[model samples]
Target chain A: MLELDRVGVALGPKAIFNDLSLTIGPGESVCLVGPSGAGKTTLLRLAAGLLAPTSGEVTNGFRETSVVFQEPRLLPWRRVTDNIALGLKARGIGRRHRRARARELAAAVGLAESLDCFPHQLSGGMCQRVALARALAVGAELLLLDEPFSALDVGLRSDAQQLMQQLVQERALAMMLVTHDLIEALRLGHRVLVLAGSPAALVYELPVTTPFNERTPAWLHEAAARLLRQPLVQASFQPLVDREAA
Target chain B: MAAWVRRLLRGIGSLTGVLLLVTLWEWGSIRYGSFMLPGPRDTLTAMGRLAEQQALLAAMWATSWRAITGFALAALAGMALGLLAGLSRTLGRVLEPVATVLLGIPPIAWIVLAILWFGSGSLASIYTVAATTLPIAFAGAQMGARTLDARLAELATAYRLPLAQRLWDLYLPHVVSYVFPALITALAVAWKVTVMAELLATDTGIGAGLALARVNLDTAAAMAWVVLVVVLLLVAEHGVLRPLQRRMEPWRTGH
Candidate 1:
């Protein structure tokens, strides 16, 4: 479990997120959905321990944590296999074992043939998969993903979402994902947190009763319609709409 | 374009450039008599004569040693200091101006100081080459270090990669890309500075042989020595540097 205990974040006197308390349980996936500049990335960074909160505490109960940034962050010099093996290499795993584990993850992420190839040779979606493989290679207890599938096309995105959801359930992994796409959040997360205000505050929490695997397109549509009915959900977009209108 | 076709075109273009240069040299030699400027034929004969004398090999080895030694030393020092400077803002600000000042000074200016410090021999020639080439290597290393993506640094931190692994896997690869190209340029500068220093400061090396040829008004011998140096430069650039550079290009592994 990862806990953000009434966390407050400020950058140069301006508050970004304030008194935000959230917990991702041992077998739970929580998604944060909000507009741009709502500090979604900053929140991810805070959870990953890349940034410290201004006030309150972030308690990490997991043995290991991994982050998937918006970018692939693959080493250009390293081949796909080596990139996937990065965490394993850091852990002092022997070359043979590291190679074995990396190959497994590469296949897990549908990049079996690209094991020998460089990151530059892979497509954007493939590179993201390599990043995913890297995270999985570490055996992270809590995985923090910031728009991991935003760069992919709709077909690829759904495929990737399916893979991620399947892995989460199979491994009983805990995840904290931030995305602007409500449907994606609804599909992957056990619970979705909606952030609103100029500097974001957790305005609403929607517990996704439907399991990720069983949720159909019809259910997703009905759920989205139900979410749109919430005044706060509509209000979250108001600021962004007003800014664009101006 | 196909790799083989591209390579063949580049080879043809290079040969054409060399022929054009030789043609221009021949024209210049004809305009001025062989006494003043030797033709390719006269220069070739003079080179053959020197080879027969067995002096050409010794002179070539002596000058080459000085150039390589000085270049190697400069590369090590410049890269070390450049990493320190590039990683720290305060160090970069302090050292960047010093490098710029060193670069602005003429290579000729360094030879006089080098001779005074090391006295006339390989030391002076080597020192002069190092002094002249240091700024180039330093600049290359600094820029290479600067090209590092901050996002990668964050990634490394998140993953908890060991310091040695970070340096080996991330930092060195990017630095080598910048450093190797600069080293190629530095190699050219090293040879030029070594020869220039040897002409004035030393009684041995190819430069000294050129001095001898000059005093005796043997224009063909001087041109032959010049040709030898140019050929060596071409070998180092095309045979060594270009091949190494191609291998270092990380994206080449993509296909």
Candidate 2:
């Protein structure tokens, strides 16, 4: 489990997170959605232990943790197989063993044919799959992803989302995924949380009772439309919608 | 054209350029007599005499050893110090100016200082070469280390990379991109500085052979020594460094 209790984060004089408390238990997938610049990445960073909260306690009880960033962060010099094996190598797994595991993960993520290619040679979605495979290679009980599929086209995005849902279910892995896309959040997460307002804190929390495999496009759209119609969700995303309009 | 055919065309172009340079050289030699500049044939004959005496091989070996050894020392020390400086802001501030000062100091000045310290031998030439080339390697490594991607560092933390793995997998790969180019430049500087130092302070290298040739007023022999130095440099660059660079940076080549 990863728990953040009344965590407050201040970057210089600007407060990003204030009195934010959350918990992600084993086998639970939590999705956070918010407008751009609403401290979504900061919150993920805090959960990943890459940032320290200015106040309150942040505790991660998971034995291992892995993160997938907004952009794929594979080492450019390493081949796809080696890149996917990075986290395994970090855990001191032997070369042959880690590579074998990496191959399996790559195949699972639909990158079996591109193992020998470098990151640059792969497309954006393929590179993101490699990054996903790398995160899985460590065998982390908790996976924290920050907009992992935001860069892909709609088709690839849905494909990646489906892949993620399947993996999370099969492994019984705990996940905290952050994104601005409402449908994406609803489609994959067991519980969806909304973060908004100045010095961001969770404004709404909704349990998504629909099964991962059962959440179809129409249901997702109808669900998202209902959530968007809520006064709090409207108020939270107003600035973002206004900015896009402008 | 096919890749190999294009490569062959490029090779032929290089040969043509070399032939053009030789033609100009022959023209100059004919105008100024063999006593002055010396024709390529005269230099080749002089080289043959030196080879028969085994002086050419011994001189080439000595010069190559000093240059290679000095470059190795500089690469080790400079990269170590550069990595240290890059990792710490205070160390970077303290050492960056020192690197700049070292770079500012001329190779000739270093040669003179080295001769006074090492007293006219291979050590003096080697020291001079190391001093002249150290700053180049240092700057490359420091830039590389300083410009490390913060995202990669975060990824390292998230993945819980061990220190050894961090250095080998994370840091070294990033640093090598910057360091390799610097090392190539430093290697070229190493050879030049070694020759310059040998000309003044040594008695057994190609530069020293040039000094001997000058004393005997043997212009052909001097030209022959110069040619030998150029060939050695070319061999070192193309045969060793380029191949090593290609191996280390196969990703960059996209092959």
Q: Which candidate number maximizes lDDT?
A: 2
Best by TM-score: 1
Which ten-residue region of model 2 chain A has the weakest summed lDDT? A84-93
After aligning candidate 1 to the native by TM-score, how far in Å is the CA of A61 from where it should be? Answer: 1.5
Candidate 1 docks with a DockQ of: 0.72
Off by over 4 Å in 2: A242-246, B1-3
Clashing pairs in 1: none
Question: Mind giving the per-residue lDDT tens digits that candidate 1 earns over B142-184?
Answer: 9998788899999999999999999999899999988888999
Q: How much is the lDDT of residue B45 in candidate 1?
A: 99
For every prediction, compared with the true complex, DockQ reads: 0.72, 0.81
Question: Candidate 1 versus the native: TM-score?
Answer: 0.95
Model 1 C-alpha lDDT per residue in residues A1-246, reported as the tens digit of each score: 899999999999899988988888897999999888888888899999999999999999999999998889999988999999999999999999999999999999899999988887889999999999999998998999999999899999999999999989999999999999998899999999988785688888999988676799899888988997899998887788888999
TM-score of the second chain, cand. 2: 0.97
